[model samples]
Target chain A: MSDSETPQDLKTTPLTSEHEALGARMVPFAGYLMPVQYPSGILTEHTHTRDKAGLFDVSHMGQAWLKGPDHETTCRALEALVPADLISLEPGQQRYTQLLNDEGGIIDDLMVSRSAYPDTEGRLYLVVNASRKAIDFAHLNARLPDSVVVEELPQWALLALQGPRAESALQTIVPGVAELQFMQGAPFEFGGDQIYVTRSGYTGEDGYEIAVRNEMVQDLWRALLAHPDVLPIGLGARDSLRMEAGLSLYGHELDETVSPVEAGLLWSIQKHRRTEGGFPGAERIQREIAEGASRRIAGIKPEGRAPARDGTVIMAGGKEVGVITSGGFGPSAGGPVALGFVPPELAKPGQALELMVRGKPQPAQVIKLPFVAKSFKR
Target chain B: MSDVKYSKEHEWISVDGDIATIGITKHAAEQLGDLVFVELPAIGKTVAPGDETAVVESVKAASEVYAPLSGEVVEVNSVLEGEPGKVNEAPEGDGWFLKLKLSELSELDGLMDAAAYKAFVDEEG
Candidate 1:
């Protein structure tokens, strides 16, 4: 939350020159000079991805490895720090979880995966938020047992190919990625390098997130752009797509003050992790699972074309209840869409909400998530 | 008809007798990019210069369109309700947001002329 920094000095991603050549508007985000939009603008890029394919530069997110002697040792070791059923993770499987504080506040949410390669049995792969990566790494290292090792990989560039035609376009370059199911990952050869490819993404679309060597990533990016269905998307469209799809953003939906339950992320915690209780904040988490969280996240659709942005106050029965964490005009949703925390009692579908826009109350309703239906290849 | 004048807030005003037409400047539209929503003040609502008279929203963000001179709203381009893209297409012409019956005609002198506004945009950018 407050730990996130808007750094004065910005770092450039490996694909910075490519983005510049494409006439991208670069902005400082998470300490990186990243493209916020391209010449085509956010609306076109957002709708294009839904109609075809879009490539996103996500190399700013941290990639690392959690290593131990074997599967049980590594999985259980990680299980101690986070609430997830890592012990039962089959090879090539990936799970999304949050690193929680002792008080049940989410320090950071991340992706943890077990490699399918026969030689890499004890190692787990991790992809974390760009802004919280350093903090996550520090929190992880200071507590992890001496037996487990963390190897941060700053030399890798991650590219996400997302949308309905993502599979067709990706198969042309990286052939075996089509075989991977949702949340499954495997190492594949691209440009003579073994890149780890996962069938997962933030957009809630059927897509692949590839981790390629920083040296070879530009080539892969160029090759992907060459596809007829593919166009380079910027962070602007990326956020809109993910928001309309009802996915969470790091600083917006989560922070040290937020709990996974309050963020509506209870599904990420498996039954074993919920009941057995050994991780940090296990007591609080289990108690929330048994009792109830006072507030929870819900999809909010403002009635008219007007958009409600982050920090917009939410009202229920003429009394303030919560505030919108993320909001904007959703190109795909055909109007304004938002996500905000509200009392669990009032977080039901069709529940009416009053959003204070420009200091005036505007009508809204709690709709089910994914303002647009997600096309994930389940 | 008076010449089109620009405000520091990036809104433009052009007076024709008692009625003045208002819209966001081209530079402002370029900065906003792909407006998805346009909320105009009601036709009889009175506004003062520098007042937040309308709301404009792009796909990623939202911004306020301020009143350039004191007036009562006489008309608005309802076409924007169905086609907000027109603002991006021709921000200074067909994309005009509203027409106001002027209450203070001399207020137009305070805004910048085209050349000055262009220089101001350049300096700010």
Candidate 2:
């Protein structure tokens, strides 16, 4: 929802009191009173994350588990909804996938990790966008067989520690976290509490996303901040980070109207799934895969200081060709960067286009994705 | 400094003779947080009191700065184009957004002084 909306009845995360204590500028985001930035401001917070480590209280994201008698059954049930090859996902490994509608449109994009914990065998841990959590849960429950149950784990809070030094900062308190490679997760003990730690993040940096019980998250947050390199970042910097990393935000880059292929997420779909054509909208998606989609998401670099924000029209030869999905000033990139959907022919890196920003036709050019190179430790 | 007045919208105007210097209040800058860009009114443009004469944008959002009184814009700050953070650094002094030649001195009577503006902000809060 809009940030300007009244937050009278907005939900607060477990760290809400802590955020207020830290003098965070609280705003209405996805029905939650979330921090947009702290007193240090967005610029410093953003640069610090790129240089050091920034801790993000992402408790607003939806965490859950899907349970069945065995991994095979659970995976098959999930494969029916998504085009990812969940059956082959090795234990402790995570795969990024999307919940697809019948029309091949995206319901929501999510991270699915096969639980490596012995006690949680035959289960899949999922993290979905907060705004679409309810819709995603209902969609999963309605589609999965009676043998599979969807469990919404509302008792957990997700925290992300991101940057080049995130591992070192976290390894100080939670030893052996460095052993976990990118996209790998495992159970860990912190302060006598069992927490799920995943070596993954959206910032395109070497980081970890820790999921802890709500009761113990505050302690974990405090312990992480105790490190000199760790700073508490808000949603403002988080948006810029992900945007620079070329990650797709739910409503901005993806929606019910956009397909995964058009969003440039074809790599997420498995070749076997693509060939089998069993998932929803497989016919259309396969067709689009074989024949390129009309419009594809591409990176845009505006020529001037002003940003070409969301919904700004893209023009080629004075004719409207596309619209910007996500656009802003990237702190690390030190300029205005944007992501938008344009005709496949015009998606080339060197192709020139004009952005109609504030009624002015500003010169822009298509650029390679991930304006900043990814630094994820493989 | 005693000649400065504030608008309910959080704009500040300082009058010396017929020229008025205008900028946003510190409270406004703090609320906006981290100015990334500032679009100043064009020099030589005429503006009436309450007209949107400038725009201040932060990473989060953009807010319009309304004119405090009827005036003809005399000078616009171009330094903000290279470093908008000046608005957040020294909004009252070096961050002054524009200078205007007052067309109607009576418009100042409708504005609030520093004390009245502080009270107004507290009441709104």
Report the lDDT tens digits of candidate 2 across residue range A1-378.
345667787899999999999999888888899999999999999999999999999999999999999999999999999999998988999999999999999999999999989877679999999999999999999999999999999999999999999999999989999999999999999999999999999888889999999999999999999999999999999998999999999999899988899999999998888889788889989999999999999999998877788999999998999999999888888878899999999999999999997688999999999899999888
- What DockQ does each prediction reach against the true complex? 0.83, 0.69
lDDT accuracy of residue A315 in candidate 2: 100
lDDT of 2 at A18: 98
Interface RMSD of 2: 1.0
Native-to-model Cα distance after best TM-score fit, residue A126 in candidate 1, in Å: 0.4
Candidate 2 vs. true structure, TM-score: 0.98
Q: Per model, how many backbone clashes are there? A: 0, 0
Model 2 regions lying over 4 Å from their true place: A1-5
* Lowest summed lDDT window (length 10), candidate 1 chain A: A1-10
lDDT of 2 at B6: 93
RMSD to the true structure for each prediction, in A, is 2.2, 1.3
lDDT, candidate 1, A1-378, per-residue tens: 132445457788999999999999888888898988899999999999999999999999999999999999998888988888898889999999999898888999999999887799799999999999999999989988999999999999999999999999999999978889999999999878889999999887899999999999999999999999999999999999999999999889998878888899999999877888898888877778788888899999999777899999999998999999999989889989999999999999999999999889999999999899988876
Q: List the residue pairs that clash in candidate 1.
A: none
TM per model? 0.96, 0.98
